[model samples]
Target chain A: MTPIHAPDVLISEVGPRDGLQSVSGTMSTAAKCLWIDALAAAGLREIEVASFVPPKLLPQMADAAQVVQHALRHTHITVMALVPNLRGAETALRSGARKITLPISASQAHCLANVRKTREDMVAELRAVVALRDAIAPGVPVEAAISTAFGCTLQGQVPEDDVLRLAVACAEAGASDVGLSDTTGMGNPAQTTRLFKRLFQEIGERTGAAHMHNTRGLGLANCLAAYEVGVRTFDSSLGGLGGCPYAPGASGNVVTEDLVFMFEAMGVSTGIDWPTLMAAREPLKAGLPGETLYGMTPEAGLPKGWRG
Target chain B: MTPIHAPDVLISEVGPRDGLQSVSGTMSTAAKCLWIDALAAAGLREIEVASFVPPKLLPQMADAAQVVQHALRHTHITVMALVPNLRGAETALRSGARKITLPISASQAHCLANVRKTREDMVAELRAVVALRDAIAPGVPVEAAISTAFGCTLQGQVPEDDVLRLAVACAEAGASDVGLSDTTGMGNPAQTTRLFKRLFQEIGERTGAAHMHNTRGLGLANCLAAYEVGVRTFDSSLGGLGGCPYAPGASGNVVTEDLVFMFEAMGVSTGIDWPTLMAAREPLKAGLPGETLYGMTPEAGLPKGWRG
Candidate 1:
């Protein structure tokens, strides 16, 4: 199959949701809104603003509805939220989320640990969530992000067949899109390319973002391998804020600044204003004091004659 | 040209040389010998042991001759040293270094700043050094490492043609091999692949190790790109020591642990025993009390079921 080289790639910012959720401190709703607005202004077309879950369980995302309400004001950006079940999906849709992602673990152990349900049970929950979306919010799109699609910290070595089977189940369950995630960051570039190529072959147009972690320092390499196999949308975080609780000492998502620099330097436009995207980090830093923000490009400055 | 997929790729450890040279702390010859012994025990076949430079200029490498002599005790490991000129090359050969690498900056500004000489003057120096190796130490191999081959902090955007021309000059100057060094860590994978492919076309089998830095966090990605283009022999530092002094805030050489993990996970053999290689870091840490060490694989541990 020929590799798809798109003129522009979509960099979906997930810092507010994924970045904040994993950290200890809770960002204020107002601070979250400012961060979201800065991201939007930096030409990010998609932003996963919040996750719909009980405030008691995750106080970090307690202001999910408020954050979503504010993010929806930027009509140009796709306001996204994470949902665990039908109730969360309903809440997300009601809060004006254009996109809702449901995470289904390919590894049974991770599935049990993360959502307190079996993989089959999670698929059933996804089916219910999709049904609710179609019934009450037919226009809103629900995407199933297959977590531990690469490997699992609990079970380890999640088979490719299991991941493909789960993805097919999600597609068959009325979900609009399916994405593969390296939740444990146990992916090598070769494995990333092979799995993503198979994903495109199986799910075709339903294949979505590549959510790779920098836990083992293969995040960007894995992303590049996926891109080489025609996967365009990439999920990344500003400052690489979120760490993998499963993989000790492993960093969080791929840093957005470095990713943008890679694509832009290669002559592939990400449509992000370089200076503006970098400026967005200021508010993020202000909101999360004492948190160690990680990004190489921001620290190293741009290369000589770099206009991006 | 077909990409070379060697059963075993050489991991040329540059920690004792590049790692020590860049950092402020000076490691004693005894500590250096312990680190070298551990590296050899880990199955590393080759290591850049030290730099043959004036002690007054770099007190970090004051025991260069002692380090090289101690490293030579391991008959299985090839002792290598960096040489800046014919004088250093002679010193390295007399000290029983099997291999000597001379760095030639591709960027004129970097060449001036690093060695206080123009590019043309450096080419002349390489010629003299190669001649000295041929005359005095006929068995010792000489390699010219084109530093800042990617780009430069002082003179950003080193032209591809200039780099190719320099490689040709070094090859013509009787250097046994010519390698590319991302001295400023300004390389992306695309540029890396493009440049290395061109190098093979120009120099053929004379193309040597790819010395990539983890400065902008694209070190492993850049190495993968070079490997994909048929280049073999990677130069990396244990625990990711040796930051680019030219590029502020840039990290160090590609982490040896992370690089090994990448290739080993992809079914590419690195020969080095995983646990033994990680154990080598203990000596490195003990030698430098306050210096910061880096490597994701050491921190994250090995993936489940990893035998190597």
Candidate 2:
């Protein structure tokens, strides 16, 4: 439990969702549930089990509803899923996800190039999704993940003003919280602190999870920068899964093991045990045999006398 | 250059000294020069070039004199060397090193275990070394690094009072600066911030670099916490080389390539280019073939269209 004075940091494992989405192989829904159970047993309070996008777009997530159903069995853990628009959000709600993340690209160029939607159009679509979620799961939380918040591959540098504007619109359009993502893994500590501070100050308490990439290896450091300024929730993929196809080796989200290691080792009480968290990696690697897994904690093991 | 009022973070590469001391292989003089040159080319301004300990203790650093001589060829970088006592300090002074670090283990157990000296005895030994450096190299900067600032494997739960007292003694004993180290890789972010804040407030401008270990995987996060509370310099090993023999995989220092990637990608201006930095990893790895290298940046390529 978080003390009123110093709230505990929330490490949300995105391995099952974001991690699997970018990989080549498909993990059976049962294997994913086992992985999710392992993560929750290790004390991860939230897990992004899968995304609700159409199977045609993401065949790996064909059984999103099944994964969500299994994840809901562990009532203590908050089950989250990614949704692109109204249809995906509707699917996620039906699958019993308590939280749905709508990825809204902050860069128009990236939104058009990747999602085939303009920034304004994405927000307009989100309004309907938010309405749909309210109708189905009235108390469910809706998050607008502002992808490419730091910079983008297609657009280069994402202007800070554009990020803030989208954040405001997301909140106004009914997103319960807004997140910042280094979709291309281009964030530095200085830029991270600047942008996150601006978002919190401008948007008040609506700032959400810090979705960072390990591409440039700044993922953990960038996350720390965000945490220093009041971001409690963090998104990380296991084994540093999902390399940016454009930047090979950069796709893994910040390795969940490493992030948990950082918080737990620092005596910050991340509620994760090094041994149990590390044990979860085996299932992840077993599910994706040929894919190269990235992370140092698993290979190096935890330092001696580390408390959970 | 950091913008006015923006946070300034320093990347102190300790590959040549702390890194090589632990590995079994002796790097060819040419490989050392190439690695140091490559690091400088990648915008790493401060690097610990070599240790001045006796060759019998660490044959890997046998080429310290030659390595330091070669590093001097690059006028833009700051070359530092580690010295165990006055003898090593004298050797470092003879080699034209402008910066010298004297390791003083804060944990009495680590001091006796690592340097074969008692805490009081080491402080007395350091006072003499400081005097020797002042007489031999008047203008050269000498820093006393207080190791095991957080916790110790040998003693466990190092008293914060011991760390603070050692910091005061080092400064009072003629040291130009004082630094803290988590030699056992047991530091946490909250403890890091509190310790740094206490040290800075007590010693003010005398605080120096943060030498951390990635053994438990919180090195970068601890560095971020220190930076938040006003620590400016950070020490990292190249290829994440160097760990305590007692702590398996604790041998890797926080990898220089990954640390640089973290800072640069955040647009924090490490001044290091990704390609050049990645290219440097080859020499580091080539020097020790069987030794496992740890780092996220080199394994994962930089994000696409990365500006720096």
lDDT of each: 0.86, 0.80
Docking class of 2: acceptable
Q: What is the lDDT for A274 in model 1?
A: 81
Candidate 2, residues A167-263, lDDT tens digits: the string is 9999999999999988877777888888889989878788999998766556777787888788989998777777642134446488887787676
Best by the lDDT measure: 1
lDDT tens digits, residue span B1-308, model 1 = 01144346888999899888888788888889999999998888889999999999999898999999999899988899999887898999989899999999999999998888988998999889878888888978889999999988887799999999999999999888999999878899999989999999999999999999877778888888888898879999998888642135544689898898898888788887887888899999888887777777787888774542
Give the Å error, residue A62, model 2: 1.6
Error of 2 at A260 (Å): 2.5
Q: In candidate 1, what fraction of native interface contacts survive?
A: 0.60
- Weakest 10 consecutive residues, lDDT, candidate 2 chain A? A243-252
Clashing pairs in 1: none
Can you tell me the DockQ of model 2?
A: 0.43
Candidate 2 ranges with C-alpha deviation above 4 Å: A1-7, A243-249, A273-275, A289-295, B1-10, B37-45, B69-78, B241-250, B264-295, B298-308
**Weakest 10 consecutive residues, lDDT, candidate 1 chain B?**
B1-10
Residue range A130-165, candidate 1, lDDT tens digits: 888888888888899999998887787988999999
